[model samples]
Every structure is written in structure tokens, then in C-alpha cells.
Target chain A: MIRLLAKPVSAVWLLLMLATGLSWWLGLDQGMSSDQQSDYRYISSGLIIIAFIKVRIVIRYFMEVREAPLALKLICDAWLVLVSSAIIYLYCLGPVPVATGG
Target chain B: MTSADCFSAVERKVEIKPHVPGEVGVWVFILGDMLIFGLFFIVFVYYRGLNVELYSHSQATLNQNYGAINTLFLLASSWFVAMAVDDMRNKTVKLAPVFFPLAMLCGLGFGVVKIIEYREKISAGITITSNDFYMYYYIFTGLHFLHVLIGMGVLVFLWRRARFAATQADVRDGAVIEKDMVLIESGASYWHMVDLLWIVLFPLLYLLK
Candidate 1:
């Protein structure tokens, strides 16, 4: 396993899996009653962070953007940062942060 | 073109910047796709912000295990695709032919799993009309599912081309290999985008609170 993780790609994959687990843990309170759960923003921030890390990993390692020219890498990296920030900002704009379905 | 060879030659002599992967056009498409999906993410979050309770309650009704399994499927497939690219880079062209198909199989498996999950949801009378959250869930996952199908099509094309290139590599010069390398790189990049979208979607739709 250590030998496997030595590869940058494999390391990214492992981190992605671990991040997935973290997100899962963050939402495990789904099974608990209402009082047991923390607020959405608190849990979602962690999820968004992991989401950012995972996207960067996929772009850098899997997509081979790490070895690419500066311009290409910058564009992809910018997308990773900005879009996630926008989502988080939108998600935090209001108190309830979600609307009921019609 | 001896682009790959030229890069190596330049590296052996002087230090210059490496070239972009594949064609610039493909990267343009990837960028466009990212913007489109980014818009979707913003829109989903915007809607979710309006009524957190309904969204959270509807989210709870989802089966996290299904989403988790689908995520594993995509991640495993991505590893396979990455390995295929690595195999080609190492001049182990034969290995790419094998790995590419394995990656496709994994992608196909994800579709199968997603279909099953969709069926279960529909049978439970949960659907786009079920709730505000369900509407977004179906729309987002449905659009993503469409991308997966398109990706698989692209993968098939790449597999065929790469396999042919491998055979040509046995007889032709290294340029053949380099030509196919860029193609493989481009296709794999697109496929990774699909996986990347799911990475965020899984947590937001299924795992996060």
C-alpha cells in the first residue's frame, strides 16, 4: 500500500477516498434526530473543502496538468478555487439555505 | 509531429516550458464544461439556501450507500484510466489496451449501479416532482449521467484509436506513439472532469448535511 501511495496518482486517489469518508462522517447525523445534528453550514464547509481538494487533485495529477504549461494549469486551478467559493457563498446567503419543493 | 520527442530533446539540452496536453481545443471544451457545471452548482446552492429544512429532510430520504458505491465506481475507473495513460507514457503500449477496457468496464458498472438506484427511487415514488430537493437531485444527477454516457462514448473512441496506435507502434516510429499519447491524454482529461463533477455532487447531494 505504501509503495502504491508513492505514486502521485495513487496518493491522490487515497486522499479522495479518505475525503469521501470524512464527508460521510460529517453527514452521519442524518440518522439522528433533529437536535443531534449540527447546522448545515458547519458540515457543508468541510464538504466543500474536501470537494475543492478533490477537484484540484484530479486536475493536477490525473489530468496531468501538473506537468502542463503555466497558463493551462492556472486556468484549471482558478476554476477549482473560484467556483467552489461561489457555491459556498450562495449556500450561506440565507438562514434556512434551502427552499421547499412545490 | 515529433512533439514528444522534441520535448525530450529540448529537455536533454536546454530547459524550456513543457507544452500543453492534447490539443488546445480540447482544453477549451473542458473549460467550457467547467463553467457550465459551475453555473449549475451555483444554481443548486442558491435554491438550497432558500429552504434548508426541506432540502435537508429530503436529502435524508436519499440512500447514501448508493451514492457512495457510485463514487467508488467512478474513482476506480479513474484509476484505471490514469494507469492506462501511465502505461502509454512508460512505452508499455500493450498495457494501455488492457487498462482502457478495464476503465470502460468500470464506467459501465457505474451506469448500471446508477440505474438501479434510480429505479429504487422511482419505485419509492420519489422523483423530480417529489420535492424541491428531489428536483435538483434528479436534474443534477441526470445531467451528470448524460455526461457519463458521452464520456463512455469518447472512451470507446479513444480505446479504439489507442489500440490501433499500439499496433502501429509495433511497426511504425515513435511519432505514432506520441500522436496517440496526446489523444489519450485529452480523452482522459475529459473523463476525469466527469469524475470530478461526481466527486462534489456525491457529497453535496448524498453525504453532506
Candidate 2:
């Protein structure tokens, strides 16, 4: 099992698992003491960014796009940038920060 | 047996050829599916922006533990599939057969979790019509669950194929393994796509503040 975890794919798995835990913790309500609730918009934005980074890791490592041809790599990266940017853009464009109902 | 040693060992084994990881046709399908889901995410977010309170309130009603657990499930399933593909590529057929079923088991776990989540939501009287957020929640997750179901079938098919390839590996030249890899990689790529979509969907529906 130790040897298996040493393998590149397995190492990537560990990283993904760690990232998931971080995202879960970030999503939880621990840090939102009344004063910090307004800061959640930034936290929310950061969460979206972290989510996309995880997606890219899955694409490159798990899906083996790292060894793929340039064209395929470009297409995948393009999709990532476009979708992530668009979501963040629209998310911030909203009329106000999300109300925490504190 | 250090991590660096293992990394270099696998690195040396896999030739760094710049080719598609699977069948070209499958990628076409995968990319097209991604495009559609991308549009779905954008549309959902646009509408949510129009009414943050409604969406966020309904989102709070969701059991986020289920979503996070399911994300881990799909990530694990993808990892198993990746290991299987790597084993097959290295001609270490012994683990390939085992890894495929392990992956399927993870898929099964995802299905079970999803069903329980749906049941919980329904029992709470939060059907699709409960609100726009629930509407997108049910539809997006339902569609993804369908993909998981199909991916489970694909995993079964790949498991059988991996078992067959393992049995045949000793009798034939390396050419046989190479031939089997195309199909294995194609199926594995599809499975990874399923995982990737949920990676994006999880935060969009469950975690985003």
C-alpha cells in the first residue's frame, strides 16, 4: 500500500482527497462570525477557483491529458478558463453579496 | 521504494508520446458533453444571481455532507480507473482486473449515496417544484446520476475486458496489450469525464457561498 501511494497516479489521488477536504471545510459555516459574513463573497469566489483547479488536476493527471497532444491540451485548458472566468464574472456581477441570514 | 523512485520507475515505463489518451471519437463526445454542462452551469448561476436569497436559502436546506461524500466517491473511482489504465499500459495485468472492479464499487457507493440524498430531499417535501434552486438541484444531480449509472455499466464492460486481456497477455506478444489499451483508455476517459463534471457541479450546487 505504501508503494502504491508512491506511484504518480496515487499521489495525485492524495492531493485530490486533500483538496476535497479543504473545500468542504471552507464551505462550512465556521468562519462566518457576524462581522465576517460580508467577506464570504471573497470566500465563495475562492471556492470556485479552488474547484476549477481541482477540475484541471483531474483532467491533466487522472485523465492523462498531461501526455496528450498539444491540440487536446489546448482545448481542455480553453474550456477551463472560459467556464471558470464566466462563472466568476457572473457571480460577482450579481446585485449584492450573498445574505448569510445571521 | 521511495516516492521519487516509484515516480521515476513509472515515468520510465510510460513513453511520453504526444497522442490522444483514448479514441478521438470519444473525446469529441466528451468535449461536447462538457460544453452542454458548461452552459447549464452558466444558466443556473445567472438565474441564481437574480435571486441570491432564494437560491442560497434553498441551498442551505441541502445536506452538504452528501454532496461532499459523493465528490470523494467519484474522485476515488477516477483514481482507481487511472490505476487500472496504468497497470494495463505497463503490462502488469494482475492488478488491472482488480482495479476495475474497485472502481465500480466506488461508483456503486456514489449511486447509493445519491439515492439516499434524493430520498431525504423528497421526504422533506423538497421536490423539483419546491423552488428554482431545488429544480436545478434535482435536474443537474439527476442527470449526473444517470451518467454514473451508465458509467457503472461501462465499468462492468471494462472489467470483463480487462480480465480477458489479462488472461490473453501471457499467450500473446505485447501487441495484444497495446490493442486492448485503446478500448480501456476510452472507457477510462469517459469515467474520468463523469468525475470531472461532478467536480464542478458539487460546488455550484452545494458549496458555493
Candidate 3:
């Protein structure tokens, strides 16, 4: 089993699975009593980060983006990080403040 | 032209191979698809920002276990596809038949689990119209599920095509092996993209706080 996962491609699949489990546990923990419960930015950010990591692995290994040219690789890597980071940023911002029309 | 000159031209083409997966056109499509999905994700987060409490409450109702199961199957399917591609690259064409079907079966497992999850939600009086979060959940996941279905079709095509690689005819028809491989690689690439979408979707819908 260990040897199977040692292969670069298989290692990515194992890592992705482990990351899913870790994020599931993170989601289950509310981290505070009911009286003090609130949106946990730390947890949300962690989840988004895990998502980006998993996406990159999928693109690089499963999609064979690594075997492709550098251009495709950069496009994929950038898309994964940019969108997930944006999601996390907005998630941490609480609520969008509505602007009033003049 | 002399035979030596023709051979040299072929060698040059090999030396200067165009670096793209499956086909250059498919990569263009993949990038465009990712861009569209990225836009939707950004829009979702923006809306989520306006109604955090409602979104959070609805998110709490999601079954993380089902999402995790889907993730496992999708990843397994992708791994099998990758292995198939590797076998093809190594010229072990005989293995393509085994790997492609395994990949498809994993994909089938994911689809079954997703359908069951949707059924559970529907039977419990939850649905796309139930709330804002559920709406996004159904829309995104429903679209993803549709992609998986289409990907399964492509996998079936790949499986049928890969079978030729092992037959006696491929020994005579070299082009048959090459053509089938290109199709398999292209289909596998699309399947991986489906897995990538679900990778982000799982955390966004089920696991994130």
C-alpha cells in the first residue's frame, strides 16, 4: 500500500483522499459552545485552502497538465488558487454591505 | 524528396512536439469551461456574503458523508484514468481495456451515490427551492452530475475503442491504435475536469464553515 502511494500519481490521489477526511472533521467541529457560535473564518479559510490543494493535484496529476506545456499548467494552477482564494476572502468578509443610491 | 529527407522531417516533428494534452483544442475548451465555472463560484460567494446566516443555516443541513463518498469515488475514477494513460504511454496497450472499465465503474459509483443523496434530500422535503443554499447546491451539483453522466458515455466509448488495442488487427493497422489512444486521452482529460469541479464543490458545499 505504501509502495503504491509512493508513485507520484498515486500519492496525489492518497493526499486528496486524506485532505477530504481532514476537511470533513474540520467542518464537524463548531469550535465553540452554542451561546458563542459564530462564523469561523479560520475553519472556512482552511477548507478553501484544502479545496485549492485538491484541485491543483487533480489538474496536475489526473488531467496530465504537468505533461502539457507550461502555459496550460499556469492557466490551471492560477484558476484553482484565484477562485478558491476569492471564495475564502468573501467568506471571511461576513456580509456584503449594500450601497445606497444617491 | 529522398526517403532519408522524409524520415528527417518526421524526426523534426517529433523533436518539436506541441505540448498540449489530448488535443490543443480540448485544452482551449477546458480553460474556457474553468473560466465560466470560476465566474459562477465568484458570483456564489458574493451572494453568500449578502446572506451569511441563511447560507450557513442551509449549509448545516447538508450531509457531509455523502459528499465524502462521492469525492472518494471520483478520485478513484480519476486515478484509474491516469493509470490507463500511463499504460498507453508505456506502450502496454493490452492494459487499456482493464483500466478504462474500472474507471467507468468508479464513475458509475459516484453517479449512484449522488442520485441517492439527491433522493434523500427530496424525500426529506428538501429541494432546490427550499432555500438559497439548497438552490446553489442543486444547481452546481446537478450540473456536475450531468457532466459525470456525459463523462460516463465518453468512458464507454473509450472502453470499446481500447479493446482494439489488444486485438490482432492493431498489429496490422498501426493507425487504429494511435487513433484510439488519442480519443481515450481526450476523454480521460474531460473526465478529470469533472473530478476537479467536484473537488472544489465538496468543500464549498459540505465541509466549509
Per TM-score, the best of the predicted structures is: 2
Per-residue lDDT of A41-101 in model 2, one digit per residue for the tens? 8878988998899989999998889999899999999999999999999998876653666
Q: What is the DockQ of each candidate?
A: 0.57, 0.79, 0.59
Candidate 2 matches the true fold with a TM-score of 0.93
Candidate 3 stretches with Cα past 4 Å from truth are A1-6, A34-39, A95-102, B1-18, B168-175
Candidate 3 lDDT over residue span B85-146, tens digit each: 76555343666789889988999899888888888889999988998889999999888898
* Per-residue error (Å), model 1, residue B144: 0.6
Write candidate 2's Cα lDDT for B1-209 as tens digits. Answer: 99999986665343547779889999999999999999999999899999988998999888888889999999999988998888777764778899899999999999999999999889988899988999999899999999999999999999998888788765554457777787888899999999999989988998877
On lDDT, the stronger of 1 and 2 is: 2
Off by over 4 Å in 1: A1-6, A30-36, A96-102, B1-17
Task: Judge candidate 3 at residue B28 and give its lDDT.
Answer: 80
Q: Could you give the candidate ranking by DockQ, starting with the highest?
A: 2, 3, 1
* Model 3 pairs whose backbones collide: none
DockQ of 1: 0.57
Score candidate 3 by lDDT: 0.77
